[model samples]
Target: MTIKPFQVQNMLRHYGQHLDQGRRMARYRMLLQRASPEDVVNLSQDGRRKQLVEKIAAEIMDSLMVSGSSNPVVLEIKEELEREFGFGMEFRYLPLEPELQILRKEGEELTEVVGEEKQTILQRFWRITLAKVNETML
Candidate 1:
């Protein structure tokens, strides 16, 4: 079984790129507090799972700096996370120009409703977790 996509997105939103480092760690810890045995069935020990998840979070956050979606490093991390917690990370590319314009317009409207800072958070969240990695990175 796969970890819910939204759950994985939540983790990245709190821990991934564009977040201040100081806040990221704290947020990561906060995120971990919500994790339960149901989230990671393979690890019988909570401590072990916590440690592993922390490491993976850091790795994913760091990898997001150099690579976006389809990043091999992130892909590998995804595999490991799936094995451990059943987390699922799916790749998507930036939309075509026309679609992108529409998305950006919508995102702008969303920003107005959600606040600019929150929009940035959501942008980074989707960028790190969904945007496909560049071909050069391969």
Candidate 2:
């Protein structure tokens, strides 16, 4: 099944949170800052360095979320997930509807809205899980 843009975004968010829970932001930053132009250029020449670059990129994307920049992180995460899962994913931004705003202001009644969001997120998680399975089969 084709993954929806929103689903990919949700996966990126979940992965970012997972990285934060691991407290690996500092290490990730150090790696990125220390990576030389030559190191980056030579990454294709060395499998280990290539893997390191991928890991660093993932971590940097996660760290960016901590810095209050979620867009770039979301983009990188979507790309990485597509690469790792071998599935096509895209992102599109649409303005939030007025109903959503009203729901947000509903306080306790917002539970229903929150529950719907959570359910959507869970559906995205399942898609990612299936993507992983599909990748393994290939």
Candidate 3:
């Protein structure tokens, strides 16, 4: 299934650092103020800070399936998010179900079979993502 656009916005709201860093930090804490007790359970699970932050990051990143296999920007995004937000785990893997993996592999194979002329959809997707990110940063 395609990733829903709302999910993208939610991820950005939860994790993206605003160009105004202090505003972004305030936004995150404001989000926590609305959390349920269960949601806040990670806060004191191991330590007061790092563990909780990593747990929250893992929870957010677990919901995504970034398609690239060897993109440096992916790591850069993760590092920047972690640094800017002062919370987040290192992105080591994206857990996809078997069906999702099969679909991804098929897409890669199809790209090879179709040649470079058939990449408008991917380009459009990237454009949309970048636009969303820029809007969020603002």
Which residue runs does candidate 1 get wrong by more than 4 Å? 1-19, 41-129, 134-138
TM-score of each: 0.26, 0.23, 0.21
Top-scoring candidate (TM-score): 1
- Cα error, candidate 1, residue 77 (Å): 21
Decoy 2 TM-score against native: 0.23
Candidate 2 lDDT over 1-138, as tens digits, reads 899999999998777556454456455577789988877543354565445555544433334423345564345544555465454433211132211111222333432224665355335533543343334331
lDDT of 3 by residue, 1-112 (tens): 8999999987865443332244434557988889877774545533654444444433333323232224343455544543543443322221222111111223234212
Identify the runs in model 2 with alpha carbons over 4 angstroms from their true place. 1-22, 25-44, 70-138
Sort by lDDT, best first: 2, 1, 3
Give the alpha-carbon lDDT of every model.
Answer: 0.45, 0.45, 0.39
Cα-lDDT of candidate 3 = 0.39
By descending TM-score, how would the candidates be arranged? 1, 2, 3
